[model samples]
Structure formats: structure tokens, C-alpha cells
Target chain A: MKTTPEQSEQRDGTATGPGAGLGTRERIVRATARLMQRQGYEGTGIKQISREAEATLGSVYHFFPGGKQELATEAIRHGDREFAEMLRRALESRPDPAEAVLAVAKDVAAELRASDWLDGCPVTATSLGTAAHAPDIRLAASEAFERWRGLVRDKLLACGFGAQDALELAHTVINTLEGAEFTAQVARDEEPLLIAGRHLARLIDSYR
Target chain B: MKTTPEQSEQRDGTATGPGAGLGTRERIVRATARLMQRQGYEGTGIKQISREAEATLGSVYHFFPGGKQELATEAIRHGDREFAEMLRRALESRPDPAEAVLAVAKDVAAELRASDWLDGCPVTATSLGTAAHAPDIRLAASEAFERWRGLVRDKLLACGFGAQDALELAHTVINTLEGAEFTAQVARDEEPLLIAGRHLARLIDSYR
Candidate 1:
């Protein structure tokens, strides 16, 4: 049997689905995340996700009876948590919290360049596309943000900052990082992110 | 003749267009802005814009020979500038720069609540929808961010900060505020923005 180009790409699992080894259901979720990261929620198509996941359209419905909205909600929640964990692990490589943040920022910068600026946290992007009708997706995105904030807050707590200051600084870092990502993508440059990283490092140092 | 609901809405021009007194061409632009603000670039339909604007479908093509993309580009540019002006005027009503920022944040929070969270910075939302394929729209959004950043920089310079620090602080404030707005929308609360405002005010105070 001959495979089409999109099917061949899916068979290789390269263009999308970093976790191609996952089950069919999870593969669909990953593919949804990858597509949404680039084209955003409305821009991403279900047919594309089905092809990318190497699953039939029926499988998508089987896994998510609520259709694209359900898949999108899962993708947002999964992508955000997975990205935050990767950031956390990479950040742990440095001994100092400030340096760790700088290091993580550098890592994300490299990833952005590698992805040709196609990748971003899709939670807010998805929320923008669905906020009118899907309250559950909005709430899921909010939880994802809170979880990411906790990552920063935990690092500060470990760095010996008090809870109050840690919480405040966490908000600052998360807000700055997310904003920089948007600016960086639009500008087609990573300098905004690098500058944000430096500023966060300085901010953390001040608290230290 | 008595008007139907949608016709009444179009005549009043209040369900969407903030500028109810606008001419037909301008009304089309304003209606596009309002729908795009709620549903994003891909989600907003040109027919809907025409209906909301009370303009004929023929007029849409007449104004935008370039079609939906062209209309979208115009809508984003006009909406962002108009919204910024309103924010600027209101922000200027306060005496001090810090107070002005806080006031602006408060005003946006109120607006968000009133709009049922349908309103956001349409420039960023539109860019996300167009980022993968449309370079023109992305550049428009980048310019819009620059314009907004200038708003903060001007205030900082007036508040006696050095030119370099003013620019940096201005970036910080814009990035944080944009990011906070996203977070607030997802959370369905204004606390993120309020916290961001207070932090920005403190940063400005330190420079002062």
C-alpha cells in the first residue's frame, strides 16, 4: 500500500508528535498540542491532527466525544504542564535560582529558534479562540497557569525567599515570560525573551 | 417600519461597534474590530461584520479588494489604535504616572467585566490567528506593541527616569500588562492585572 506524504510524515512522527510512542488517545492529544502551538486553536484543523497522530477521524471522536473543544482542552492542559515540567527540569541544572531562570530562558530561546517560531504556550491562544462558549476550557487554562506559577514559587521558596515575595516575584516572572513569548513571536526575534530573562535574573537577585 | 432585533442592533450599532455614530465604511471597520476582539481572526466572519455594521456584502468587497485578510488587517490596526487612545486619555486623567497605570488597569478590568470578557487587545489576538501564514498582520501587531510600549516609556521619562531605564521599564510594564490580561481572562478575574499594576507602580517608584 502506498502512503501519502502527510501519512508518511505521520508514520515517521517527526513533524508532529514528539511522543509518538504514546497510546492512540495520547498521540491525538500530543498532535493537537503541536498543531495548536503553531497555528493556534482556530487555525489548527482536526483532520490535520488525525493525520499527524496516525489515527482515524473516528478515533478522535472515540477519545473525545465533545470533539475539537474536548481535544483542545486536553491539549492545552497537557502542553502547559509538559512544557512547565521541561522548564523545571532544565532550570534545575543550574545551582542558583536566578541562574536557573536565565538558563531556562536560554533553553526556551533555543527551542523557539529550532521550531522556527512556530511553538508557543497554546493555553492563552486556545482560550482566545474558545472563551465565548467553553467555560471549562477557560478554567482548565487557568489551572495550568496556576501550576506554572507554582513552579516559579517553589523555586523561590527553595531559594529562601519568603512566601509573600516569592508569590509576587512568581507573578512577575510568569507574566514577563508569557508576554515576552508573544512579543518574540511577533517580532520574529528572541531578544525580547533574552532581555526578559536578564531582568528576571536581576529581580531574583534583588530578593536574594 | 418597526425593526427586527438584529436590525435594531445594527441601527443602534451598540451590540458591537463602540462608535455608533460612524459612517458605513467606518462602521464596517468597527464591527470587524468588535467581532475579532471576541472570536479572534479566523473565528470572525466577514458576513457577520457586514451584518453587524449594517453594510451590504457588496460594500465589504468594495472596501477591501484584498478580502478577509485585508479587512482583518485594517480592523486590527484601527481597533488597537482606537482602544489605546481611550486608554491613554483615561490614564492621563490621573496626576501621577503610577496612579495613571493603576487607573488604567482598573479601567480595563471594569471594561473586561462589562464586556463579559469578550474584549481583549485585538491586535495580539489577530496576530495569533494570522501568525503562521500572514507576515503583514504579524508586523502590524508588532508595531501596535511598539506603540503601546511607547505609552509607558513616555510616562517614565516624564517621571524623571533615565532614558535607558525608562525604555527597559516601559518594556517590562507592557509585557507584564499584556501577559496579565491573558491570565486574567483565563482566570475570569482581575486580580492578575491588579497585581501586575501594583508591581509596575513599585518598579517605577524604585526608579524615581
Candidate 2:
């Protein structure tokens, strides 16, 4: 059987095909996420994404028929999953739930410090930019948030909080994490993240 | 005595003079703030602000010699003060500190609902947009946040929390409010705001 151009490209990771391999798609998504993280959804362009991804315009449209909005939706969902997994791993590394929450906070602070406070939660940036301009993107971002919240809620429930209490606590945890991220990013200091994390730990302790 | 052009414009609720009248400046700032509340600092343009305020581009430059950045600075500061004042009034209106906090939360929720969740904290959009691109804008945003945190801290202290406790609590409250606003705006729902407020009340109750 002879492989078609699209099939060959899909298999070789050099062309646009259903089997175009994961690397190409990953690269495109990563590039789009990075640009969106810096300039926001409205400010970023598909051309820039193509250039950043080292792929051509045809390749982008081939992979994402819905164009920038669809590409952004995919990138946001990818980032949310990757970030939540990383955070969950960080939390699980600690023995105590309180300590795990604090550890995750520190990890967030460390990441910000390493990036010179230039990076923030991609979901947050996307949510703000598209909440009004693009409803589908907003919904996609909201799904990511609910997923992250579920992760946190499960952790709190494991720590003995009731289901209702755990849900509320999870909301606070995420809210504080996000809020502290913005504060730390703007101030170029880890104090906000550290302080917010400590306060979150105390909140968990009260439940215990 | 004949009224100067500035004086006449000031009296007539217009700004058509050399120095520019209070009405014109106020209108410009208010319009800019409103635009920023919906979009963001980078997302908005001077032309848009001029049109919204019913003024000319020349008038914007005349009022803000430093251009868009300068206009944004003034608008963000004005927003900061207005938000602080609203918080203060809300907090002061209620006898109990916890009740005061809840009241402000309700007020914030109502405002968002009234606007169909289109409006959000003015500085949030700007802060996220400028966090990576413009350092000066980021600094300005940070200062505004510090001022807001200070106000919230004072209210918490007045309600009987210790200085350290109050500061920590204030940080959480602000973070929750900010996060909730982001979620509400993205979800196009007011429930997140109310949920954040209720969670905040619980945290405060535990301390009290």
C-alpha cells in the first residue's frame, strides 16, 4: 500500500495529515499557548503562531480548521491538563495535605521566580481575553477550571472535609492560587504566593 | 469679570479651553475606565476612548501628554480609588466586619449581574495584559493592588483581627474576590461571586 501525501506527512511529522504525528500538533499548541500567555488572545495572530511553531499557514489551517479560536481552545485545554497534573504531582509529593497545598504554592512561586514573573496561568489570561469576545473559548477555559477544581476538591476530601466544605475550600484554594500568581507576577515577589499558601494551609487545618 | 474659556467650559459641563476643564478630564477618565473594565489596557485604543468620551484625539493628547500609556495610568488610578471608596463605603455601612465584607461582595455581584457579567475589576484585565509586555503598567497595577489590600486590611483590623491575621485574611479576601470576578465574567454567571463571598464569610467567622 502506498502512503498518500497527507498520510506520509502525518506519519513523518513533516506534513499535514490525520497521522501527522503528535510532535507537530504539540509544537503548534505550545507555540500558540506561549504567544497567548504573553500578549493575550485578541493580540495574538495565527501568522505568529505559524511562525513560532515553525509550521506554515496551510499546516495551521490543515490542523485547525476552526482557525485561531479553535487552535486557542485546544491550547488552553492542553495547558490546563498539563498544569493540573503538574500541580497534583507536586501536592502528592508532600506527606501532609496541608503541606501538599503549601508545597504546590511554593512550586508555583518558584516557577514565577524562574520566569522572572513573566508567566501566569494561561487559563486566566485566556479567560479574561475571550470571556466576552469568544464564548466557546470561554467555555473551554471554564471546563479546564472545573477540572482543576475537582483535583483540589478531591485532595481536600481526602483530608476529611465534607463534600460541600471540600468544594468551597477547593474554590478558595484555586482562587487564592490564581490571585497570588497575579500579585506575585506584578510585584515580582514570592511573598504573595508564599503568604497566600500559608493562609490556605491554615484554612485546611481548621477543617482537620 | 469675564469668564475665561476654561471657566466657561467648566461651568457649562464641557471642556473646550486651553487647560481643559474638569468635565472633560472627568469624562475622559470615566470613559477610559469603563472601556478598560470591559476590554483591557492593551486591547483598548485612544481613538476608542476619544469616541466613547465624545472627545477628539487631540483632546486626549491634550489631557494626557504622555499618550495612551499615560491615559491608562490615570484611568487605572482613578479606578483604583473608586473601587477602594466603594469597598470602604460598603464595609462601613454594616456594623459587623464580616457582615460588611459580605455586603461588599453582594454589591460587587450585583454590579456584575447588572452589566450582564461584562464588567469586571478594572485593573484585572490591564494587569493580565500588561503583566508580560509592559513593566511600567505592571508596576502601576501592583501599586493599585497594594492600596486595595491596605484598605481591606484596615477593615479587617477594625473588625478585631490582629495585624498579621488581618493582613493574611485581607490577602485571601482580595484573592477570592479577584478570582471569583474572573470566573463569573468567564462563566457569564453571578454565582461564583456569591460563592466567593460566602467562603470569605466562613473564613472570617472561623477567626472571630
lDDT of 1 by residue, B1-208 (tens): 1233223444443445455545566778888877888888888888998888877788789878888888888988997798679767965787687788877778777887777777877887777857878888888888888888788788778777899888887777777788888887878788888887887776666666
TM-score of chain B of each: 0.87, 0.88
What tens-digit string does per-residue lDDT give for candidate 1 at A62-118? Answer: 889999889989999887888788878966777688888888777777887777887
| DockQ, all models | 0.61, 0.57
Residue A118 error, candidate 2, Å: 0.6
TM-score, every prediction: 0.88, 0.88
- Which run of 10 residues does model 2 chain B get worst, by summed lDDT? B1-10
Residue pair clashes in candidate 2: A10-A19, A10-A20
